[model samples]
Target: MHVKYLIIGAGPTGLGAAHRLTELGEHSVLVLERNPYAGGLAASFRDAAGFTWDIGGHVVFSHYTYFDNLVDALLGGEYLEHMRIARVRIAERWVPYPFQNNIRHLPPDMQWECVQALLPGHRREVAPTNFAEWFEYVFGAGIAKYFMRPYNFKVWATPAEMMSYQWIGERVSVVNLEMVLRNLVLQLDNVSWGPNNLFRFPQQGGTGEIFTRLAARLGDKVRLNTPVAAVDPASRAVHTADGQTITYDKLLTTGPLDILIRDQIGAGPAAAMVGDGMRAAAGQLARNGVYVAGVGVNGTRDDDTCWMYFPESNAPFYRLTNFHNYSPRNAARPGHQRALMAETSWSDHKPEQLDTLMDKTIEGLVNTSMLHPDETARIASRWSIAVDYGYPVPTPGRDDALRCIQPWLEAHGIYSRGRFGGWKYEAANMDHSVMQGVEWAGRMVLGEEETTYKL
Candidate 1:
C-alpha cells in the first residue's frame, strides 16, 4: 500500500494530524493504530458494571485557538464546562491547592514554619540545576519541604534532584509571597491558580469520547488493530506484523521514540550507530509508570471537589479525581453512584505491588478520608489499569536525547510527535499533544515552521 502520509498510533497526535491533513484537502492519508480503538492513552472504557473510566485524569483545556476550535466543533453541545476546584490532602487536613499560597489553612505552628522560611528575602539561585534546587529557590525551604519535595517525589516516581526544571512552565504553581501573606493575614482562601483553573469534559462519555468522535469523522482512513512491526525509512516503507508493507512519502509516528529506535529502526545502514547512543539515552530517560484504579460506589458522595493531590506517604495514590463528579453519566448504578480515579506511580526507585494494588488503593482512600471505611459495603465496581507510558519524566538528559533522536528521524522523512514521542511532559498535555500533530502536518504539507516540536 502506498500513501502520501502514513501516520502511526491513532491517538490524539495521529488523529490530530490526519484531521488537519484532511482539513487541508489532502486525501491520501492512512492512520494505523495498534489498539482496536483510537485515543491511545487518552482512551476510555466502560467496565462490566457500566461505569466509564478514563485512562487517567484528562481535563480539556487548550493553549491554542486551533485546539479549542477542534474540540468545540467535535463535541458541540455534548461537552460540559467546569470550574476547577482542586485541593491537597496534607497533615490529615484538606487545604486549597497551590499549597504554598494557602499555607494559612495549616495548623498554627506549621503556618509559622512556612512563614518564617519565607520571611527572609527570597533566595534566588544564580544557576539552579535540578528540580529540587529549583523548588527550594522558588518556593523557599518550608514550602519545599512540606509540599513540593515529597509531593513531587510521589508524582514523578523519581527523586526531584534527578529531574530538570525546564518543563515546569504553567504546570507547577510558584509561590507568590505577596498574595500568600495577604491571604494568611486575612484568613482568605487562595484556590485559584494554574491554567486548568477552568476546563471542559464530555457530558456523556469519559475524556476518550473526544478522540473517538474525531476518529469516527476521519472514517475509512483509520486502520485499527494493525500494529507496525518495523519501518524501513531507507525505502520509506512500514512493515506490519502481519506481513503488510506500507510505503509512504512521509511518515508521522506518535509512538515512543525509544521503542521506535530500538525495535523498528534497529541498526539499519541509514545509520548503524543510531541505535547505540539513542538506546543509551533512552535508558537514561527518566519516566514513571502509572496505575489507575477506579473505585465505584453505589451511594452518593458528599464532596464536590474535582481532584485532590496527596503529598504524604500515608496514601498509596498521589492524586485522585472524582470521576463521577466530572460527569454524572460516569456512574454505572441507577440511583446514586460515585466514582473515584486514583493514580499511583511506580519506577525503578519506587516499586509497587501490582497484585495487591487495588486493595492497597482502597485502604489509601480510606486513610486519606476520600472514602469512608463503612462505604466499602456500598462498593459497586473496582478495576485497575497499568499504563506503561504514563508521565514522561523531564530528566536533565531528556532535552539532549531528543536533540539527538528527533533530527535523525526527520532527516529520513519520519516526524516523531506526541507525549512520549516528543518526550516533553510540559507539552505532553492533551491540547499540546494535538497541536503538535496539527503543527507537524502543517510543517510537512505546507512547509510551515513547527513550534511545539522544537527541541
Candidate 2:
C-alpha cells in the first residue's frame, strides 16, 4: 500500500499529525502502531471492576490554543473543566505544592531559616553552573538543603547537579515573597499557577479518552498490532513485523526517531551516531515513576485535595494523588469513596526485583503516612508500569548532543520529533508531544515555520 505519509507510533503525536493531514484534505495516510490500540503509553485500561485506569496518572492541561481547538473539535462535549487543588506532603506534613513557596506554615525557626534563604540580599548574581547550583543560586542554600535538593533527587533519580535547569518556567514554583507572605497569613498555600493548577478532565475515561477518540476518527486507517520492522527510506517502503512491505512518499516517525532509524539501518558508525542522537541526555529515563498502588477507600476525605508530593529522604515515593479529586470517576467504589494512588521511582530498570518492590512499596507507603498500617481497606487493585521511558533526563550534555545530531538526521530526510522522538524531557508532556507531530506534518505538507521544541 502506497501512501502520501507513512506515520509510525500511533500515539497522540501521530494521531494529531493524521488529524491535521485529514483536515487539510491530505488523506492518503497510513498509521502503524506496535500495539493493538492507539494512545501508546497514555492509553487507558478497563479493570475487572469496570473502572478505567490511565496507564499512569495522566492529567491533561493545554497551553497552546491550537491544541485546545483540536481537542474541542474532537472530544468537544465530553470534556469537563476541573479546579486543581494539588498539594505536597513533606516531613509528615501536608505542605502545599510548590512546597517551596507555601512553606511559611512550618515552625518559627524552620520558617525563619527558609525565609533567610529567600532574602533578596542573599541572592547575588551567580551564573549557576548546573541544575543544583541553579536551585541554590535562586532559592539559597538553606531552602535547597531542606527540600529542593533531596526531593528533586528522589524524583529525577539523578543529583540536581547532573541535570540542566533550562526547563524551569511554568513547571517549577518561583516564590513571590509578598504573595507567599500574604498566603501564609491567610493560610491559603497552593501552587496557583501550575499548568495543572486548573485543568480539564474527560468526564468518563481517563486522559486516554482523548487518544481513543482520535484513533476512532482515523478508523480503519490506523493499523494496530503491526510493528514496522524496517523502513527503507531509500525506496520509501516499510517492512512490517508480519512482512507487509508498504511504500510511501514521506515518512513521519513519532517512534523515538533515532531507534527507528538505527534499527532500520544496522548498528554501523552511522547507526551509532543515530543511536547517540536518539539516546540523548543521561541515556536514562530520569523521572521514573512507580505507581506504589491505588487503594479505594469506602469513605470520603476531610478535604478535596489533588496530588500531594513529599520532598524528603523518608518517603519511598515522592508523590501521592487523591485521584478521585481530579474527577469523580477516578474512584471505583461507591459515592464519596476515596481513591489514593502513590508512586515510587528509580534511576535504573531492574525488572527482576519488581516482585520484591511490591512489598517494599506497601511498607514505604505506611511509613510515609499515606496509608495507615492498622486500617485494613479493600485494595481495589495493585498494579505498576515501569513506564518504559518515564522522563527524559536533561543533563548538561543533552542540548549540545541533540543540536549536534538532529540536523544530521534531517539532512537524510528524517524528522526526529516527539517527547522521546526528539528526546526533550521538558517538552515531552502530552500537549508538546502532539504538537511536535502536528508541526512535523506541517513541515511535510505545507513547509511551515518549525516550532522549536526547545524554546
Candidate 3:
C-alpha cells in the first residue's frame, strides 16, 4: 500500500496533521493509531459509576491562535470556561500557588527563614549546571529547600541535579524578591502566575473529546488499531503488526523518538553502530511515567477549586485535579457526585508498585484530606491507569541528542513530531504538539517551513 503522507499515532499531533491536511484540500493523507480510539494520550474514559476521567490532569490552554481556533471550532459552546483555583499543600497549609510568592502563609519562623534567604546580600553566586543548582540560584535556599526541590523531585521522579534547567522557561514561576516581600508583609495571594490561570475544558466527554471530534471529521482516513511494528527508512515504508507493509513518500511519527530509534528503525552495520550511539544518547534523555488514579465519590462536591499540588511524602500523588470541577457533567449525576484525579510519577529512580498504586492513592487522598473518613462509604468508583509516555524529563544533553537524531530522520524523509516525538518538554504542551504536527504537514505536503519541531 502506498500513501502520500503516512502519519502514526492518532493523538493530537496525528489528528492535527490529518485535519490540517484535509483542510488544505489534500486527500492522500492516512493516519494510523495503535489504540482502537483516536486520542492517544489525550483519551478520556467513563467509569462504571458514570464519572469521566482524562488520561491525566489536562486543561485546555493554548499558546497559539491556530490551536485556540481549532479547539473553538471543534468544541464550540460544549466547553466550560474556568478560573484556575490552584494551590500548593505545603507545611500542612494550602498556600497560594507560586509558593515562593506566598510564603507568608507559613509559620512565622519559616517565613523569616524564606525572607532571610531572599535578602539582598544573602544571595549565593553559584554557576548553575543542573536543575538543582538553577533552583538554588533562582529560588534561593529557603524556597528551594522548602518547595522547589522536594516538589520537583516528586513530579519528575528524579533528583533535580539529574535534570536540566533549559525547559524551565515560562513553565516555572520565578519569584520577585520585592513582590514576595510585599505579599508577605501585606499577606496577599499571588496565585495568578501561570498561563493556565484561565482555561477551558469540554463540558461533555472530557479533554479527549476535542481530538475525537476532530478525528470524526477524518472518517476512514484514520485507521485505528494499526500498530507499526517496524520502519524501513531505506524503503520509506512501515510494517504493521498484522504483516501489512505500507509505503509512504513521507512518514510522520508522533510516538516516543527513542523507541522509534531503538526498535523500529532498521539499518546496516555501520548505520547500526551510529544507531547504537544515537540510542545511547536518547537513553540519556530522562523521562518519568505517570500513574493516574481517578476516585469517583457518590456525595456532592461543592468546592469550585480546580486543582492542587502536594509536596509532602504522605501523599503518593504530587498533583490532584478535581475532575468534576472542570465540568459538572464530568461526574455521573452532575451535582450528586464528584471525580478526583490524582497523578503520580515514577521511573527507575522512583519505583512504584502498580497493583497497589490505586489503594495507596486513595489512602493518600484521605491523608491529604481530599477524601474524608466519613466519605469513604460514598466511594462510587476507584480506577487507576498507568501511562507509559508521561512527562518527558529534560536532561542537559537532550537538545544535543535531538539535534542529531532529528536531522538524520529528516534526511530519511521521517518527521517525529509530538510530546515525546519532539522530546521538548518546553513545547510539549497540547497546543505545541498539535502545531508541530500541523507544521510538519505544511513542510511535507505544501513545502512550507516547520517551526515547532526545530531541534
Q: In the order shown, what is each candidate's alpha-carbon RMSD?
A: 1.5, 3.1, 1.6
lDDT of 3 by residue, 142-168 (tens): 888888988999999988898889778
Per residue, candidate 1 scores C-alpha lDDT tens digits across 59-119 of 9998899999999999997888899998999888999987888998898888987877776
TM-score of each: 0.97, 0.89, 0.97
Considering only N, C-alpha and C atoms within 3 Å, which residue pairs clash in candidate 3?
none
Error of 2 at 79 (Å): 3.1
Runs with alpha carbons beyond 4 Å of true place in candidate 2: 120-125, 177-190, 267-292, 334-336, 349-352, 452-455
TM-score of 2: 0.89
**Highest lDDT scorer:** 1
Better of 2 and 3 by lDDT: 3
lDDT of 2 by residue, 1-455 (tens): 78888788889888888888887788898899998879987787656654556665678787788888878877777767777776666656667667777786676677777777777877535799888988778777667877888778767777787888987766687666677677777887656667777677777777788898999998878999999777665565778889888887777777764455457643422344444545552243233434445555566647677677777656566667776676678667635566666666675531225556656666766777656776435455565555645566777776776776566556656566776677777777888888888887787878887674652
Stretches of candidate 3 off by over 4 Å are 266-274
Ranking by lDDT: 1, 3, 2
Worst 10 residues of 1 by lDDT: 267-276
The lDDT per prediction is 0.88, 0.70, 0.87
